[model samples]
Structure formats: structure tokens, C-alpha cells
Target: MKIFKKNLVKMTMKMVGSLALFLGAMVIVPTSLVGSHQPKCPDELLK
Candidate 1:
């Protein structure tokens, strides 16, 4: 029983770590692409 619990904990941790990495990449890739473009705001909207 103890061994099974340990394995379960390890598996959960691995899954959580992978999920975090995927989410981080999802956020970072878009920001990096937008940053590279540096879109300018339109002059009409400045009013």
C-alpha cells in the first residue's frame, strides 16, 4: 500500500510539472510574437 501511494504521488507531480511547462509556453510564445511585431496604435484612436 505504501509503495502504491508513493508511485501515485510521483506520477501526479510529473503530470503537474508538465502541465505547468505547457501553460508557460502557451503564454510566452504569444507575448514574444506580439513583442517582436511592436504594433503601433492608430492616430485616430488617440483622441
Candidate 2:
């Protein structure tokens, strides 16, 4: 019973950590997109 409780707690923590990381990435991605410059490229560069 004790082992089961410990395992449950570890799993819960892992899940919460993953959720936090995903949320952080979600917020950061759009922020970088908004701050980026327009496609600065010539016709040759497009190839």
C-alpha cells in the first residue's frame, strides 16, 4: 500500500510538470511569431 501511494504521487508530479512545460511553450511560440520580421527575402532567396 505504501509503495502504491508513492508511485501515485510521483506520477501526479510528472503529469503536472509536463502540463506546465506545454503551457509555457504555447505562450512563448506566439510571442516569438509576433515579434519576428516579415519574410526578408529576394526572389533568388525564395528558391
Strongest candidate by lDDT: 1
Per-residue lDDT value at 36 in model 1: 98
Off by over 4 Å in 1: 39-47
After best superposition, candidate 1 residue 31: deviation in angstroms?
0.4
Candidate 1: clashing residue pairs, number: 0
lDDT value, candidate 2, whole model = 0.94
Tens-digit lDDT string for candidate 1 (1-47): 99999999999999999999999999999999988996789999998
Cα-based TM-score, every candidate:
0.77, 0.69
TM-score of 1: 0.77
Which tens-of-lDDT digit does each residue in 1-47 have in candidate 2? 99999999999999999999999999999999987867677989779
